[model samples]
Target: MNFRIISALVMRYLFLYSRSPMRLVELAFWPVVDLVVWGNVTVFIQKNTNPEFGSYVLFFLGGMILWDIMFRAQQGVAISFLEDVWTRNLLNIFVAPVRSSEYISATFIVGMLRILITAVVLSFISWFGYAFNVFQLSWWLIPFFLNLMLFGWSLGMISTALILRWGLAAESLAWAIPFFFQPVVAVFYRVEDMPAWSRPIAWCFPPTYIFEGMRDVMKSGTMNWDYLGYAAGLNILYLALAGWLFVWVLNLTRKRGLLTKFATQ
Candidate 1:
């Protein structure tokens, strides 16, 4: 946990993005696209549905905002690691004084920074474009946002560990793995909307509880501590497991002398 090393690593990544216009656009691309597509759909539904059905824009926009948090958080770490692999720099990094913990710490910080940028930008668009303010949902927004970020970070760790062990063949997991949970997360729909057979699997994801609670608050104007509590507890467990798995995989890679293979391939 050397702060100097962590700062250096963070600066390195910042410099990479700062120099590349395409990379900066990529950070905002998917999120803005998701908001526009879903925002319009939400508006259309509101006009067509019975007024009794109530406004759905909040739910739709809220889900999209939170889901992107998870996406950006996961990509922030997993892709940062992949950048090292793509540039053949992993060996150079590890051969230096940088420890695994320090590297992860720096990536986590950068990921959070990305989340903040995305959150603020999306929040503005949802407000002006759709007349939906996520902040109005509740004060509980803070905890729910944090819970989703942690879950994303845990998933990123697992993805990185898999890539480290199997090489670039598994690099697709960095982008593909997060979407695997999207169906189960029930982001735009309730858990009940999931097939009965898949309900249990959906519940296994912590975001399911957060979204469920989000819907509860939207409908009743009250927060459900139970859902937030469940999300927090599950995040702690998953994050610990992810951390352990990453260290285990890194050790195996070193034992087999595969860092060169990971870096060069």
Candidate 2:
């Protein structure tokens, strides 16, 4: 966990983005599009529905923002690794003095920076475009956002591990894997709205509690720490599992001489 090595990796990613305009646009594009499309739909729903239904803008925008936190966090790590793979730089980084933990730490820091930028942009859009103040959610938003980021980072770790083990064939997992948890996360709906069988599975995801908690705040204007606690607990477990899996896969890659093989292909 040397800060110099970690900073070097972070600076490498920063330089990559700085040199590519498309990369910066791509980083902010999907999140803005998601907010615009869904923000308009939320306005439409609010116009037609009763007040008791709560703020559709908040509900929709909150979900989108939180979901993107996880998405950005996951991409921060997984895509950063994939960037190395695409440039055939993975072998070079690992062969250097970089430790596995340092690489991950750097990715996590980069992901946080990305998430912050995206979140700020989307939050302003939600406020001015939709007249929804996400910051109004107050202190509860802190843990909600952190929990989602942790879960996203965990998924990112697993995605990177799979890519390491399976080579380019597993690259799609970088983008597609997070979607697999969407339905189960109950992001846009309540946990009870899910099928009973799915409810059990949904509970396994940390975001389920966060979104449910968001809805609770919208309706009652009260925060539910219980949901946050449950989410935090689940995030810890998932993050630990992800870390172990990443290390195991990395060691296996070295033992099997897959790093060199992957670099060439």
Candidate 3:
């Protein structure tokens, strides 16, 4: 892929965000809100449940902080894609010199940057206010975070595909899709803790393994790279399928003479 094309596309978003103070605020605002609200709730629960289980609060708070990283990664792609959709610029973007590969790369690059910024902000809040430090995960943090990022990108691509296929009717998914996986992904509980019927669905997601590994680390104070491997494997599969689905939907939309008229629909 041409770096220039990717750079241009990425810069467009960076410039857009730079110009608007509210856009900058919006980037980190909701996450801070989530951290604050959930952080307090977890603390309250810890206080009530048992003071001896001090890690209980961090369990919930840490889960939430890590969860938001994936969420922000997804929003980076889905919401950035939506900006083009909302402005009726999808056609313009496609007709330009940019290739599909370059565009997708740009989205991922942009998404990665957005998530990193959000992660830094959340880390500070988590560290200072909650007395929780994500860095404590050490080397294990890399694989889990990377897998989650891949999963988030895959989901975002699928969401973009659906919106391209179904128009504004499917727009709500950009904001809502990640939440759909929250319960099933074992963010706060182990996959086995879920019902038998739901466990099948849970395993299909990479975050399920990552969280399982995460919980194991919390409970045992040891690294379990096996779960990270599972997560990485699932992420590879998820990413392949997501890219194929997006291209397939894009082709179908084009064949149906939908791209030119997608914005109106």
Candidate 4:
């Protein structure tokens, strides 16, 4: 873990984004679009026509903004790895003094930065445009948010591991993997409200507890330490497994000479 190596890798990734305007716009574009559409839709439902939907305002917007945190964080790490593969630059980075651990650390740091920027942008829009302040969830939002990020990074790392092992053909998992868990995580709905069969599956995902805890806070105005603890526990477990899988796959790929295949193709 060389700080200098990590910093160099971070700047290299940042430089790629800086040089491409579309890449920069992409950071905010889809997220803003989601916010506007959902914000307006929820506002519509919260109007005088539907008095019962009043409580849902927080559930919808808050859920969305927080959900995006996980989505974007996952993309940050997974896509950053994909960028190198897309550019045929993986060999260049790995062939240098940068250890695999350093490369992974750099990706996580970059992911954290992207999520922070997007979080601020989405929070601003939710505040002025939708009158939804995410921080109103209180300091509890900190642990919940961090747990989502950890889960997201775990997913991202696993996705990256898949691509490393399967080559470019498996790249779609970088973007597709998160959505698999999306429905089961109960992002916009409650776990118990889901089909009885899905409850076992839903509870396995770390975000499920986070979102459920959020709903509990919204209704009761008190934090549920149990949910936070459960989410944190699950996240740590999954993150450790993700790291192991990535390192294992990297070794397997290297032994099979797939790294050169990735570099050439």
Candidate 5:
């Protein structure tokens, strides 16, 4: 409700990142590594073995861009409280006029902004460098991308609440959850090449649908409504679950006085 307070927090977060731009390089590591390793590997494989693999590489790259957006957004939500714990600024924030709900709202807005910025940067690079033709022409994916971003924000907030409860030990959860999508992404050559049982696990990640959709749109110029609906539905359900979990965790932490238990550390 207090847009001013939320906007202030969002601006502060962006300013901090602007001051220490090197930190972005640290955040950009995973996506760049993905682009380099898989980019060359896919080109090599397709040139020598199967040219079909070339499209797979492009699809995977797009998925990496989306995955990176999710990862960065999660980091924003999960680590927003870390500075307060690490540097003692959180005490001042709590003592300020802002309520917990306002703070939570600020975190969500910042996370979405972070994800959108990353998506734009990655999209520019992919389109020019590799001739990523899928999203270049199809602007319809914007709504789908926004939905995925909302789902990611909800999950990020839940992870942030866990971190607020257990401290830095919960940091691993942020990375671990996103890491599972790596092998399932299109960059991995062939999903069918993997074991039969693993195929189901790979399909479970929403980005798989995203990659498939991008490929279909690029190659066939037709949308895959079935896959899109399934992924969208699953994300909506997960977003609800994530919001519920975040609220529960936040209440528990407040009651237990665990939100600041590790602040002095």
Candidate 6:
């Protein structure tokens, strides 16, 4: 795209947030609550349950920190796009010189930046006071964080495409996506503690590897590169699947004129 057009779209996208600062603050609330409230609850549970429960608490917190990063990365983009629906201004924006790809690119960039900033601040807060440190050197966290965010962003785009094509039932998107990590999160409870049959299901979410890799690095001071590699491979496959689904769904919506039925504007 031309610099002039890109600059204009970027400006419009940035300024859109300026118009609603409360949304940003509201986004901050849940992550902070997770750190403070759940962090304390986990600590309490671990103390009473067993000495090994401490490790479980630590693992659970690590998974949660990463989970929040993934969730918000998706939320940042999905919510931003949905704002257009709420305001009834999406058609006007689309009628501009900006192409669909350009619009998607701008939204993704803004979403990534927002989530990065959020991760840095909250991760730091958790490290100093809450005992949740992912990287000993802190710099090692960059790759892990990037991979999770990209995985989330790809899923976010697919969800946004579906919402645009089907209906703007925002609550459905909110409820469904995070539970995909439920199996992975069960690792905190000790996968073996779960039924033998359920272990395979938990292994499906690639984030389990992501969390396992992070725990290995922080707790053992060595990288689980093999698991990391597995997580990376799964992210690539998921990305392709997400892209294909988005295109197919969008086309189907257009064919049925469902696009207008759920059109943002």
Q: Pick the candidate with the highest lDDT.
A: 2
Task: Give candidate 6 regions above 4 Å deviation.
Answer: 1-7, 45-56, 184-193
State the C-alpha lDDT per candidate: 0.89, 0.90, 0.85, 0.88, 0.68, 0.70
lDDT of 4 by residue, 1-265 (tens): 8999999999998899889988878888988999999999888877855666676766988788888889888988899999998888888887888887898888888888889888999999989998888888898789878999999899999999999988889888898999898889999999988999999999898899999988888878786788888899999899999999999999998899888888779
RMSD value for candidate 4: 1.2
Relative to the true structure, candidate 6 has a C-alpha RMSD (angstroms) of 2.8
lDDT (tens digit, per residue) of candidate 5 on 1-265:
6989989988888887788877667665666676667566656766787667555556666556666766776666766766556676776787699876788778877777766666666666666666564365367567557655655666677777677678778768765665655676443345666778787876775656666666666567777788777778777777777767877887787788875665555
Q: How many angstroms is residue 75 displaced in model 4 relative to the true structure, after the best TM-score fit?
A: 0.8
Better lDDT candidate (5, 6)? 6
Instruction: Please give the TM-score that candidate 2 achieves against the real structure.
Output: 0.97
**Candidate 5 ranges with C-alpha deviation above 4 Å:** 27-29, 181-205
**lDDT assessment of candidate 3:** 0.85
Q: Per-residue lDDT for 1-265 in model 2, tens only?
A: 7999999999999999999999888878999999999988888888888865646546878888889988999999999999998998987987899999999999999999889988898889889998888887788788888998999999999999999999999999999989999989988988897899999999888999999988788667797788888999999999999999999999999999998999767
Q: Give the TM-score of candidate 3.
A: 0.95
- Residues 1-265, model 3: lDDT tens digits: 7898899999999998898889889879998998998888877777778776756556677688778878878888888889898777887898999887788888898889988888899999988887778888777788878988999999899899999899888999999999999999989877777999999999888998887777777767786777777888989999999999999998998899988888544
The candidate 4 region of ten consecutive residues with least summed lDDT is 48-57
Give the per-residue lDDT digits (tens) of candidate 6, residues 161-224. 7687657665478446765666554535555667888778766656667676776765676776
- Model 2 alpha-carbon drift over 4 Å, by segment: 54-57
Off by over 4 Å in 4: none
The clash numbers for all candidates, in the given order, read 0, 0, 0, 0, 0, 0
